[model samples]
Target: MQRLTVFLCCIWIGSLMYGEMVAFWRPYWKCSWPPLQQNLTEVPHSHEGFKVAVITDPQLTDYTSHGLTPGSFAVKAIQFFTDIYMRRSFRTSLLSFEPDEIIFLGDLFDGGPYLSDKEWKESAERFEHVFDQTQRGSKSRLTGIPVHYLSGNHDIGYAGFHSHKREVIERFEKVYGETNYRMKIGSVEFVIVNAQTLDGSMNENSTSSSWNFIQNISADANPLPRILLTHIPLYRPNDTPCGAYRSSPIINQRISNGRSGIQGIMYQNYLSEDTSARLLDLIKPILVLSGHDHDQCTVSHPTPNGPVIEHTVGTFSWQQGNLYPSFMLLSVSALSSSTTSNPEGIVSTNLCFLPMQTHIYLWYASLFIITVFLLLSWPTSGVDLSYCFRKLTELAATAIRTTSKGGVKVKDEDANYEYDMVWDAEGVMHLIRKGYSKLSNANHGEVRSSARGTVVARPAAKKQTTPESDSSCVQIESETNLEQIPKGPRMTKGKMSYIVQRLFRTLHNIAVLAAVNLPLYMMLLIKDWT
Candidate 1:
C-alpha cells in the first residue's frame, strides 16, 4: 500500500507540474504538408513594389456576424477561428509597421436570404453597421493607406437572388472604386477586377474575358510589374470537354441558379486566367493578391518563361470554426531604395492560434478532478499500519454493500432535460454538444452537403426540418423508447457529489498532515540517509 501510494503521488506531481504546459500547448501542425508550390520565384517591380493586404469572405450574414436573433451567438467547432482573427490582426499590425496598401477579396455578406423579412432587414442592417465600422477611419489598415476591394460569389447574392447585391456593390464602389478599375501606386500598376458575373462561368461561348478588359489600359506600363486583384483563383487545369482554363475552388456552390443534377460542381475558371500566372506570362509584371479560401498561403512559382509570387490573405472573422486570417504588408521602396537596406523583410505575421478560453475551462476542470483523485491516495502518518488497514477495509466493505444493492441510478430530472432550437445557420445542428446532457442518439445520413444543386451529381439531400416537423424522430437510439435506461454501472449526480465530497475531505486531511509533519518529515529524511 505504501509503495502504491508513493507511486501514485509521484505520478500526480508530474502531471501537476506539466498542467500549465499542457493547457497552452499548441501542436506543430502546418496546413498542406509540402504545399504544392513552385520554387524559383522573383521580386517583381522592386522599385515601386508595395505590399498589398487582401481579405475575403467576411461572410457577415445575420447568423455569422451579429447572431441571427437577439441574444443569439454561434460557437465554433475548434481552434482555427482564432487563427482567423490573429491573421488579420497581424496584417493590420504589419500595415502599421510597413505601411502597405490593403484590399478585401470579397464575399462580405453571407446568407443573403432570411426566411423572415425582419430577419433579412436586420441582417442587412448589421452588415452595413460592421462594414461601415471596418471601412471607416484613418487609423485602420483600410484607411491609413490605400485599401481597395472586389466582390465574391457569396457577396453577390450567390447567383441572381433578389437582395442587396447591387446595393452592397454600390456601397463598396462609393468607398473604393466602381468594383472594377485600375490604379498605379508607382511603377507597379494595380487593376481591381470585379469577377462576380454569374454567366461568366456556366454559359458556353460567353464573350467575357472579363480579366482581359483590364490589361488594355493605356496608362498600364508594359513589361512593368502589374498586380491583379481577384476573388476566386483559377489554378487547377481545366478538364471539361471544351478545354477551358482551370483552377478549381475546393467545393463550389454554383455562383448562379441553373443548377445541374448535383449539390454543386467543383470547378476552376482558367489555369492562367487573369490571375498572377496569366498576368505574369502576359504583362510580365511582379506580384498578385487574392482572397476567398481564407487560408494564409504564399506561392512563388518560376515558370519556364518568368517567375511569379502570389499570396492569399485569410479571413478576418471566425466562420464555421475555421480561423484563417492573414495579410500581406509590404514596404514600397522608391526605385532609388533598391540598392539601399534590405528591400523585403517579413514584418510580424501575427498568426495567433485560436483563443483557448473554452479548452482551458475544461482542462482546469479535469485537473481539479484528477487532483482530488491523487489526494485520496496520500498516506496518514498518525495511524499505525494495522490500524490504517482496518479502517480502509471497513470503508471498502461498506462501499461494496451499498453498491451491491444498486449503484448510481440516474434521477428523473436528468432524463427530462431539454434543448431549445435557436438560430438557423447551415450547420448549427451538429454543434449541440455545447449543451451537456441534451444530446439525442440519432443516426444522421452520411451526406455533408447542406445544398442541393442541379447538374452537380450528388446524393439526395435530407430535407430541412421546419418548426412543425419532428426532428427528434431522426435521432438514433439503442432502445425504442425515449426514456429507456441502459444497463450498466449507471451514473448519478448524487453519487458524483458524494465521491467528490469524500475526495475533498481526503485532500483536506492530507494537507493538514503534510503541514503538521513538515519537521518530522525532514528529520526522517536525514535519519534515513544517515
Candidate 2:
C-alpha cells in the first residue's frame, strides 16, 4: 500500500509537471499527447480581446434509443447519455472560456441512423433539441459567436461513411447549419474540414476541391494565421515515414520503398499519422481541434521545453464505450468576417513545451518487473505456492478445452459479418432485417440462424461480396424446389464458452511468469539483506 501510494503520488506530480513542446521529434506524440508546435508563424491582426472557447463530446443520441445497445456496449446502456453531456453543460463551459467560437468534434449521435425509417425520426428529434439550444446560445454570446462542428466516425457510420455525408448535410444544416465551410475572423483562417477527408481511405477526388480552396487562400493571404478543424486524431503512437494524410503516400514510398499496408500507424507514426500531415503541411494552421477518444490528455510532442498546445475535444454522450466526453475553448481575434482581411490570426510563432510522458509502456514494464520479483520470492519467503500452481494448471486446462482435436473452430454458414469500417450499413440493414435469419433458418437455401446469438461469425464482409443471383457458384435450377433445404442451428452456444477458457489460459500464463521470476527476486533481496 505504501508503494502504491508513492506510485499514485508520482503520477499526480508528473501530470502537473508535464509541459508542451514541438512535435518535430524523431517520435512524435499521439495526436493529443504532447501539445507541441514548430515552424508556425503567428502574426496578429488588430482584433479585440483574446478568444477562448470550449468544445466537448456531446453524444446526444435519439431519445428513443436512450443510447442503449446489445454487444460489448450493451452493458453500458443503463445510463442515459443526454443527461451526461448536455448542451447546457457545453453552454456553461463555453461561457467560461469566453472564446469567439466553439467547435464540436463530432459523434453528434451514437453513430447509427436507425435501421427502420422510424428510428431516424426519433434520433432526429433528440438531436435537434440538443443542438438547437446551442445555436440559440451562440446568438446570445457577446460576440454573437459562431459555432462549428466536424464529423466523427460515429456521425456518418450509419450512412455508408463518406458516401452519405452529403445526403446527411441537410439534416445537419437544419440542426447546426453546414457540413463543410470556412470563414476568416480577425486574421485567423479557420477552415472547417469535411468528414470524408479525415478517413484516410477516402477517394482523393472528393477532397481535392477542399485542398485547392485552402491553397488559393494561402497564396493570397498575408500575415494572417491558419487553423484546421476536424475530428479523429491526425496521428497515432506507431508512425513510420507515413505522415498524416497528404504526407502519407510520400512517407509510404519512402519507408517501404513501394510496399503498402504494413502495420497500423499506432506504433509507427505515433500520433503523426496519415491525412492529418497533409492538412498540417498544406494549411500550415497554428491549431487543429479533434475528438473521438473520451479522455482529456495533452501531449507536448518533440520537446521537453516550453508552452505549445494541440486542442483535443472530449466526449458528449455517456452511453459510449470507453469513450469520454469533454470540450475546449479557443480565443478568436484580429480580423474581418470576410476571408480577405488578415491572412493569419493576430497571434502565431515558434512553440515550446516540456513533456513528462506517462509512458504507459514503461508503467506496465515496471509492474511486470515487480511482479516477477514477487513471484521469485514467494516460496522461499514461506508463502504458499498453491495459488500460483493452481493458476498455471487452470490455464493449461483452458488451452486444452478450447482447442478442437484437429485445431480450428469454424463459423456458421449464415454468420453475419460486416466491414471494420466505422460505417456499418449492412449491420444496420441486417438489424432491420431482424428474424430474416430465423425465417430463413427453416429454409437452408439461404443463410441460417439458431436459438443462441453468435452474432457476427465472419471475420469481415465486403460490399462487393454480397451474393447476386447471377453468381456462378450458386446454381439456379428452376426444377429444384427451394422448400427442400435442410435447417438446423448455424452454431451452438457451446462455442462461445471458449471465452471463459481463454481468460483462464491468459491468467495461467501470468502465473507462470510470476513463478519463473520469484526466485531471482528473492535471491537479490537476500543478498542485499546479508
Candidate 3:
C-alpha cells in the first residue's frame, strides 16, 4: 500500500507538471515561422511585414451543450477549465508569434443567439475574461494588440431567420462593433463582411445593407491588395476538396434548417454560390479568410481576373470537436515600389496548432486507472501468508531444540516411533496419560481416572526420555485442550472486528490518495482561477 501510494503521488505530480507547464507550451516552440510566399529581400529595403493572428470559432460553452444546465456548478466548472485552456493557448500564441493584431473569425459563444440579456451578459463576461489582456498589472504581450471580431451564426443567428433577432444583432454590434467594416493594417486592406446577410433569405434591409457594404468596397479603386474576412466560407462545387490540413476527407456541405425556422437553410457549410461569385468579382480580394467549419481548408476560386485562394481557419477551442485546434498567422509586407513585377506585397500564412488537449486528458485518465487497479489489487498482490506461518512454526521448533539442555538421547528406531505417536489428538492423549502414569509411579501410588470410566497406571518397565520431549508433549497437550474448548461467540466477534478493520483500512487508503492528488487535479483545471 505504501509503495502504491508513492507511485500514485509521483504520477499525479508528473502529470500535473507536464500537462500544465510543458504540454501546452511545447508546440509553440516547435512551430516554424510562417512561410513567406515571396522573399521580401528582393524588394528594395522592404520593411518588416505586419503580423496578424487569426483565431476562430472558440464557441465558448453554454447551456445548450455538453449536458450543461444553466447556473449550475457543473457548468461553471466546465466553463472555468475551458476558459483557462483557451487563455493559455491564446497567450502562448501571442507570445510565440508576437502578432501586431488579432482577429477572431466568429462563433464566440455556443448559444449566443439564444441567450437572454442576462445570460448573454454572463457569456460575454466569460469571453472577456478568457481573452482579457488589459487587466491591471497584467504584463500580457497582447495588451496593446488590436483585436477584430466577425459575427458568426452562433453569435447573431443565421440571416433571414426570425431567430436572427434585431436585439441579438444590436447586442453583438454594441460589444464587438460593426460586423461589416473595412480596416487596413500596414500595406494590406482587410474587408470584413457579414456573410450571413448574403443568403438573400434575410430581410430586404439587411440583405441590401450587406450588399451595399460589399459593393462599396468593390467600387473603391484602392490598389492595395484586399483580403476578405468573413465567418462563412465562399461556396464551391459539392465535390470541392478542403486540402491536406483538413481532418475530414470531404467538407460536409449538407444544409441544416436548424431550430431557427429558416427553411432550407439554418446553418451553411459555405456561402451561396451566387453570393460567393459576386464577392469574388466585385471585391477582387487577393485572399479570402473565413471560419465556420471548425477545420482547416484551402480552396481556390476561379475568377475572370485571377484565381483567389481562400483559407478557412480552424477552431481555436479544443472543445469544438477538433483534437488538434489551431489558428492562422498571416504576415503581409507592403512593397515600397508598385512598379515591381509583384505589387500585392509578399504574403505568408501558417497554421499554428495548439497542443492536443484530449490526448493529455487521456494520459491523465490512464494514469488514474492504473493507480486504482494497483491499489485495489494490492492486498492480494503477492506473498503466501500460510507458507509464512509454516516457516515461522519450523523456526520456533528449531529454537526450542537449540535451547534444550542435554538429556537422554533416543535411538534412531525410537525416533520414528516418537514422531508417529506425537502428532495427532489420540497420540497426544496417550502421551498425557503416559506422563500421568509416570508421575503416579514416582509418587508410589496407583492412578485412576473415573471421569469417562477409564483407568491408567504406570507399567512395571520404565522408558527413558529427554526433558525437551516432555516439555514439548506438555505444550502440545495444552494447545490441544485449548483448541477443544469452544469459542463461538468470541470468534464471531473477532471476525466482525477483522472485517471492520479491513474496511476502514481500504477507506483510509482511498481518502489519503484522494487528499494527496486532488490539489494536483484542480491545478490542471484552474491554475489561473484568480
Backbone clashes in model 3, listed as residue pairs: 160-202
lDDT of 2 by residue, 200-259 (tens): 222433345555665675565563566666665555344233222121122111111112
Native-referenced Cα lDDT, model 2: 0.43
Find the 10 residues in a row with the least total lDDT in model 3: 415-424
Query: Tens digit of lDDT per residue, candidate 3, span 1-530?
Result: 66667767877887877787677677677775564455445755555668888899999997786767787998877777678888888765545566788999989999888889999999999898888776424455457788999999899877655334668888999999997999987677889988877875544556678888887887776556788998999997887877888885567566666454544346788887888898899888889999998888999999998788899988988888888898888887655325234423456788878878888889988987786666656663545769999999999997777668344444443321122122233323343323412233233334444333333333343444443433333232222356767699988999899777666666676688778778876766565545
lDDT for residue 341 in candidate 3, whole number 0-100: 46
Please report, as a residue range, the 10-residue window in candidate 1 with the lowest summed lDDT.
31-40
Clashes of 1: 24
TM-score for each prediction?
0.45, 0.42, 0.73
Give the alpha-carbon lDDT of every model.
0.44, 0.43, 0.74
- Candidate 1 wrongly placed segments (more than 4 Å): 1-52, 64-100, 112-146, 157-168, 171-177, 198-215, 218-224, 238-257, 260-284, 298-305, 320-324, 336-500, 503-530
TM-score leaderboard ranking: 3, 1, 2
Model 2 residue runs over 4 Å out of place are 1-50, 62-81, 91-93, 96-99, 112-118, 131-145, 158-160, 163-166, 173-175, 198-205, 221-223, 239-274, 300-309, 321-325, 335-530
Could you tally the backbone clashes for each prediction?
A: 24, 84, 1
Tens digit per residue, CA lDDT, model 1, 187-238: 4556666655422443311113344464565334533345666676535333
Q: Which ten contiguous residues of candidate 2 have the minimum total lDDT?
A: 19-28
- Cα error, candidate 2, residue 488 (Å): 59
